[model samples]
Target: MDDMKKLLEEIEKLKKEIEELKGEKEKKEFMESEKIIEVIDKIEEIVKKGFSVIEGAVIGSLEGIKRSLQEKENGR
Candidate 1:
């Protein structure tokens, strides 16, 4: 039964090694997910700011055109 005992020990060792690898893989996946979330948040912020700037520019352009037309009508 000595051969059977040795085989069992080898199997246990392999199981432990497999468990460690699984843990490492999970940790790596978690880190990658966190990085993706961070990048998405940054993109959202940039899009929001970009839209605000565009809206402001559009409003300013409209006001300038209105003023120009008013001045022309008044013969100024």
Candidate 2:
């Protein structure tokens, strides 16, 4: 009977340890996902900035062309 009691206690302790390990695993996974989200956000910002720079360059080029045309007309 004493041996049976000891066995039961050991089993309960193991069960608790298993539960703790599961909790740790979940926390690790959540942290990894958050990191991935942060990386994606950074990439999105970089893409937006790249587009803005390209748009500015295009607008600047158009304005330069317009000025050149006006100068030629005035010269004539």
Candidate 3:
């Protein structure tokens, strides 16, 4: 009878420990996912800014070319 009681106590202790471990794992995973999302958001912002700069440069170049062609025709 004493052995059975001891066995039950041990099982209860083990269950609590397992529950703690599972809680810690879930917390860690949530933290890691948050960091990953932050990094992805930063990357997206940088990409959008880079494309905007490229677009501006392309438009400026086209405008310059058009002006130069108009001046040449005026000269002729």
CA lDDT of each prediction against the hidden true structure: 0.99, 1.00, 1.00
Q: What TM-score does candidate 2 reach?
A: 0.83
Give the candidates in order of TM-score, highest first: 3, 2, 1
Candidate 3, lDDT over the whole model: 1.00
User: What is candidate 2's lDDT per residue for 22-68, written digit by digit as tens?
Assistant: 99999999999999999999999999999999999999999999999
Cα lDDT tens digits for candidate 1, 1-76? 9999999999999999999999999999999999999999999999999999999999999999999999999995
Q: Which stretches of candidate 1 lie over 4 Å from their true place?
A: 73-76
Best by TM-score: 3
| C-alpha root-mean-square deviation, each candidate | 1.8, 1.5, 1.3
TM-score of 3: 0.87
Per-residue lDDT of 38 in model 1: 100
Query: Higher-TM-score candidate among 2 and 3?
Result: 3
What RMSD does model 2 have?
A: 1.5
lDDT of 2: 1.00
Indicate the residue-level lDDT of 41 in model 2.
Answer: 100
